[model samples]
Target: MENHKLGRAPDFTNACIVMFGVNLGWVLLFLFAIYGLVAAVFICLIVNHWLNWVAVRRRQADQLYAGKTPG
Candidate 1:
C-alpha cells in the first residue's frame, strides 16, 4: 500500500539522520578535546616563562644588595 510504504520510508530516513547526528557529535567532541590540550600546553609554557622571570629578578636583587654583579 502507498501509506505503508510512506511510513516505512520515514522510519528509515529518521534512523539515518540519527546515525549521522551521533557521528557528527563525536567528531566535534574530539576536535574540542584536541583544542583544549593545546591550550593547556600553551598555558604551561607561559607559566614556566613567568616563573623563570621571577627567579631572575630575585637573583638580580640579591646581587644589587650584596654589591656584586650577577654572573
Candidate 2:
C-alpha cells in the first residue's frame, strides 16, 4: 500500500530526534568541563589564601619573638 510515485519521503521526525540527542550529549560534556575548571580554580584560590595566612602568622610570630611591634 506504499505510494510508488512519492517513494515514501524521508522521516524528518526521526532525524530531528537524533539531532536533539547529539546536541544534548555535547551540552552535557561542555557543562562538565566548565564545572571541572571552576572547581580547580576554587581549590587553588583556597590553598593560596591559606598559605598566605600561615606566612603572615609566622612573620608576626617572628616579630613578636624579637620584641617588635609586628610592623
lDDT of 1: 0.75
Regions more than 4 Å wrong, model 2: 1-35
Cα deviation at 6, candidate 2, in Å, is 99
Clash pairs for candidate 2: none
Give each prediction's root-mean-square deviation over alpha carbons: 24.0, 25.0
lDDT of 2 by residue, 1-71 (tens): 46546567787998997997688567656756878667656655776798899999999999999999897
Cα lDDT over the full model 2: 0.77
lDDT of 1 by residue, 36-68 (tens): 656656655776798899999999999989999
Say which candidate scores most in lDDT. Answer: 2
